[model samples]
Target: MNATQEKHIAVVGGTFDPIHYGHINLGRAALSALHLDEVWFMPSGSNNYRSDMGIRAEKHHREAMVKMAIAGEERFAFSDWECAQPGSTYTSRTFAQLNATFPEVTWYYVVGADTLHSLKYWEEPELICNSVVLLAAGRGEQVTSGELQATAQTLRTNYGADIRFIPWEDMPVSSTQVRARYREGSFAREDLPPGVYDYMTSHHLYQSLEWLSDQEILDRCDATPEERGYYERLATMLTPRRLRHCLGVMHMAMLLADGYRNVSMEQARLAGLLHDCGRTENNALNALGHAPAGAQVARRLFGVKDESVLSAIRWHTTGRPGMTELEKVIFVADYIEPFRGHMLHLDKARRIAYTDLNQAVTFMGESTVRYLESRGEDIDPITLETVNYYRGLLKKQPIPGQYQ
Candidate 1:
């Protein structure tokens, strides 16, 4: 409340669905780069960009995640201002209200580099420009100095916008990618803050094989009576971590199957959920020791008589040649799903999964081959066969341990 000393405030707004280290680092960069007094994380309740942001965790979940991630950071804080708005609120409107509430404090808006480019197109860009200085950080998003400078100039020339790009180190992770990784049952421990991942695990965030109550999980997956018994047994038998992985694969497979015409979403769902039914047996022998056994387990134990589901589970590990669409889906889903984020080139594989499912599988195969070769381990004959079959189909050239 010191009228004499000037105070500076900056606001960064987004879904922050599962706020990660990138968001935190940007706030830190802003503080160090712009010499701001404090940075506020404004999580949007429902914005115009909601649909494009992919699946958003519930408003309260997003808020809680942000709060949890920023707990130790003194300069960073969470605000529910936009989330509390009546409807789709604009950045301009937020500033008007912000100024009205804190007239004396000078406010700045920290925009992502891409968002900064389109600032002139936002509602009342002129008023927004006049209200607060714009700060864009290139911590996670890709934008060259030349591009940022050009965009900043355009904003200034067209709308008289005050914008600056702060010094930042690029972080390769994104929330959507993080969510996908979680849904797949894999996450890089480094992507989230210390306690946040644990929180997500305990709360079953991202639908990554969340350890839900038996009935709730069965209901959510639309499990049949027979399927329910198997799921119940699996829930009790498998470790929490393994079960979560299975669920993430199931959710991811269904998601991947949604884009394919030939694949059965139901088959994809079941295959994903039970892909690891024989994981213990698989681990007992070779790396892929469980694939064939998993299919038999699905039939005898789980009662998944649907050959498509069983076959998908069978090939989920070491993919085979002449694999059906459902087989390809489960194989690729197990590789690129959220829980499998640790795999190399996963983002690329995930991106291509929707467009060209076969190509994504090849990419994953190449990565696996490369990784296995690096360790001087014996390559599985089926895995090499699967890679060669898909690679030949796609006309992809040979790589080490591939096409042999």
Candidate 2:
């Protein structure tokens, strides 16, 4: 094949303990600049250069994250060549193995300018230099264009290495920053690839829940002193079991609020904490009217003034039609909190609540109707109204104002 038709592959290798946008950008730039057919991500199994950086994630987890980060890009692929090796892997050895495996394909190695400057210290620098073309992307302000050119000329003169520079805007993201965010329980979905973030949440990586204690949950709430005083007073009125349930609901409500833009975390916390304020037998609130009673108690006792929070408290048990976002949050939290005992379809309800709030609310309403019917109990009129309203929403039909 002529040069135009020849297979050109760029290899991008790194520790990639947790791949971020910087890594993805480097690969994409290499593909565009070098006219390469594909970019392969090689996550290092072990790095001798950074052995002092503390414990790294297992090879499988690192590989999984890389796979997720690169997904949906047909030109991007990954290799387990370094990860399959038993001990420390050198760049020279990796280059040699790749050359042997794809001798007909022209190879280019993508690296940051910082790594290019440190090339002399890596194992068998001359072999690494000769193995493939080096494409160095500019890093932060530390590496200037003049400095990169000078260094590239030196390597070309001394080691016969073909080096090219690619202009790259510095992205303020690193695996260390990602890990720190995960540990602090403040990691946002935008910081990482969608699939990678989903995987991290599912696998519970990077101490995701280490900050989920009762105090930690409360700390995340942006509550004023008066609101906290209300929380303290409400806690004293419940039995131990009921108190635990309330805390769990508060935690779940905060989590749900994080996924939606309109829902406020503080509103969710206050509404969740007081949703069951009237559940006490001594308080004279029953199953049929506990929600309305709780709303009154929230207004009279805690001085809650927000209509949304009061409406959420009033309708959490038997949801009304056309509920607000805060109302939906409390309603879903009460059903799916971690402390809630086993209930049919609860797991699916929790998943739906996080993924799609409206769907979860409708599911809960329909499921409750079915459950009450199975038990031969009278279905509450408000719940029937809620079920009809959301079902109408799902079907894109206009609901009557009476239900609203």
lDDT of 2 by residue, 1-404 (tens): 46655688888898886899999999988877777889999987562212211133435557789998898987999887786663357889899888888777878999987787799999998999999999888754545567777888899999999888776765788899888888678888888875878766654555422234544445434346766676678768878677667776776776566445357777887888888988875866567678898889889977889998999999998888889989998998888876666778987776677557788889998888888789988778788788888988898453343434
In model 2, which regions exceed 4 Å deviation?
Answer: 1-213, 220-224, 396-404
User: What RMSD does each model have against the real structure?
Assistant: 14.5, 16.4
Model 1: lowest-lDDT 10 consecutive positions: 47-56
lDDT of each: 0.74, 0.76
TM-score of each: 0.49, 0.51
lDDT of 1 by residue, 153-262 (tens): 88889878877777677578789889889878788666698677876665555552334553544454455676666677787757877786776676567556544535
Each prediction's number of clashing residue pairs: 11, 0
TM-score of 1: 0.49
